[model samples]
Target: MSVAAADPDFATRLNAFDLAALVYEDGIAIDRLMVDFARGLAEAGRRVGGIAQLPPGPATEPGQVDLIDLMTGDIRPLKQRLGPGAASCTLDGSALAAASTGIRRAVAAQVDLVVISKFSKQEIAGGGFRAEFAAAVEAGLPVLTSVKRSQIGGWLAFTGGLGTLLDGRMDILVDWWAETERRRAKTRHRHVS
Candidate 1:
C-alpha cells in the first residue's frame, strides 16, 4: 500500500522531479524497499549507483550494519560499536566516505539513478551523505533516498521542497523510477544536442 495515496497531490508531485525521499516511520523496513528498488532498476539495465543499507548478516558483528554499493555490488560494514563509554552514534566515518566516492562516480558517469540509504540524524547535522546528495543534485542525477518520519523536516529543508516524497512501497518506487528515467533521458538528449 502506498502511504502517499492519502495525499491527493502526491501523483502531481511524482512527475517532473528527480530527487525523492522514501519516507517511513520507525521500525518500517525502508532499507529493504530501497534495495529492492535499486536492484530492480539495475536488473532492467539501468546504471544505478550509490549505496543501500542492509541489516547485519548472521556472521556480521552484533552492531554492524552493511551497505551494498549499487554500482559495484560491494557489501561494506556501515556501523561499528563505539564501546560502552562512547556516545550514541555508531556510524563508521571512513566507511561512509568510501560510499560517498561511489556516489561521486555515479554522478560523473551520469548514471540513470543514485540511491543513498537514508538521510537521518547524520545528514540532519550536515554530515553523512549530504555532500554527495548535493553533488548529485548539482549534476542533475535522479537521486532517491530513504528518510525516517522524524527527519522529514531536514529532508525537506535539504531538498528545498523540490523533492517528491514516496511511500514505503515497491509499486510507488517503480512508478517513480519510470517517470524520472523518462525525464532524465529527455534532459540528457537536450544537453547532447
Candidate 2:
C-alpha cells in the first residue's frame, strides 16, 4: 500500500508481494537513515544486501567516495569530479562496477533484504544500480530505497507499478520491515511444505 493509504496497523496488513520505496523530499537525511536502518536489520540477524552511503568525513572535501556495500561492509568510493568546480561530484563508473559486484554476489547468495541507497538521475537514465535492483526484485527479496519527490514518476515507471511509496519516517520503515519479514517467512514455510 502507498504511504498515503497506509493504516496504523500496516505492519500486520502487508501482503507478501509488496515492494516498497521511500519517498523523500529534499533536505532529508535519507542516506544516513538508510545506513542506520540497514545496521539495525543486520544487528537483528537479517541478511541485508545492496549498499548505503557513508557519512561524509569531517574535512568536507568534494568528490569523496561514500558508498558502502552492506553485504560485505566494504566502504567504496562512488563519486567522481565532473569538472574543475566546487560541486561537480558525479557517479564514478568504476566504483559502481566494484559496488555492483558485491551486490550481485549478495543476491546470488539470497540475502533477506536489499537496501539500495537511492534511485537518482543515473538510474532514471537506465544506468547506476538499475540492474542490481532488478535482480533483487526478480529474486523476490524485500527492496528498500529512497527517491526524491521530483523523481517519483521515473521510479514508478521503473518499478512497473509494483512499488509502495513510504514516507521518510523511521517508524514507518520499521513497520514495513516487519511486514516484509513476516511475508518472507510465510513464503519459506509454504515452499518447505
My TM-score estimates for the predictions, one after another, are 0.82, 0.83
lDDT of 2: 0.77
lDDT of 2 by residue, 1-193 (tens): 2221233443344343456788888778777788899999899998888888886768747647588989888887777756666475476778889888877887788888888888888788978888887776666667788899999988877765557899998999999888877877888899899
Q: How do the residues 62-83 of candidate 1 rate in per-residue lDDT, one tens digit apiece?
A: 6678898889988878877777
Task: Find the 10 residues in a row with the least total lDDT in model 2.
Answer: 1-10
C-alpha lDDT values of all predictions: 0.79, 0.77
Provide the lowest-lDDT 10-residue window in model 1. Answer: 1-10
Instruction: Give residue 144's lDDT in candidate 2 (0 to 100).
Output: 85
True lDDT of residue 173, candidate 2: 90
Deviating ranges (above 4 Å) for candidate 1:
1-16, 56-61, 81-89, 188-193
The number of the candidate with the highest lDDT is 1
